[model samples]
Target: MFQPLAELPPPALGEREWLLECHCARPVTDLLKAQGWDVVADLDCNVHCSSPDRRVYVGLLPESQEAARGELWHIHVTDNSGTRTWRQTFGADTPAQAIAGFLAALIAFPARYCTCA
Candidate 1:
């Protein structure tokens, strides 16, 4: 059984380093899966999770893209017609603990009124 999001242990420094370099998506993907999101992984090891109105993507992106420079995490919520209504990104140097905290909060609350959702 999956552990509750609030109870999940934060990833250690070494683990975070490994995840950043290897693009391992299990940690985040598993948490999203437990929250009823559908997850898919590509050959490049990028992970994508989607719910009815939201999508989360985690990957090692090329630094060349202006929006993706130093950012590996991407999240967005879309409208019924598929237009993105909200979006956020986290930089490469962001701590795993911070990411976990954000995700925990996100899971605990509904996204209806919040831009961070």
Candidate 2:
């Protein structure tokens, strides 16, 4: 059987300034917000979602001219009070995949973060 956390509302259009070649910020933030998370999009195009002492951040790294020459997405989670942090990067071709990876990471390490109010 399958169960959802909540009956989330549909995401609003043009609500946040999404990056041009984004692979992980916009949709992830929208999902987070729908799940009752406090999310913010920053000037650097990073989406930050937090709950109490736990924080999750998603950022996009476009194809560059340097050595790391590919499009990448980074997701990080930090538990301020627990003094722990987890970060992972993925060579994702889409924003939804990157967000799914990040969510999977969080699910794999739930004790490392705070989920309270």
- Top of the candidates by TM-score: 1
Scored by lDDT, model 1 comes in at: 0.62
Candidate 1 structure quality by residue, lDDT tens digits, 1-117: 899999988888777654333234555666677877778766755556776345444333333363356667777666667777777777666655556556768778774675665
Residue by residue across 1-117, what tens digits does model 2's lDDT show?
Answer: 555658654458767545334554566666566556677656754445664345665555444332164436566666656543777665555556456545655655757336783
lDDT, candidate 2, equals 0.56
Q: Show where candidate 1 strays beyond 4 Å.
A: 1-24, 52-68, 114-117
- Give the TM-score comparing model 1 with the true structure, all chains together: 0.58
Top candidate on lDDT is 1
Indicate the TM-score of model 2.
0.46
The residue pairs in collision within model 2 are 23-95
User: How far is each candidate from the true structure, as Cα RMSD in Å?
Assistant: 7.1, 10.4
Worst 10 residues of 1 by lDDT: 55-64
TM-score of each: 0.58, 0.46
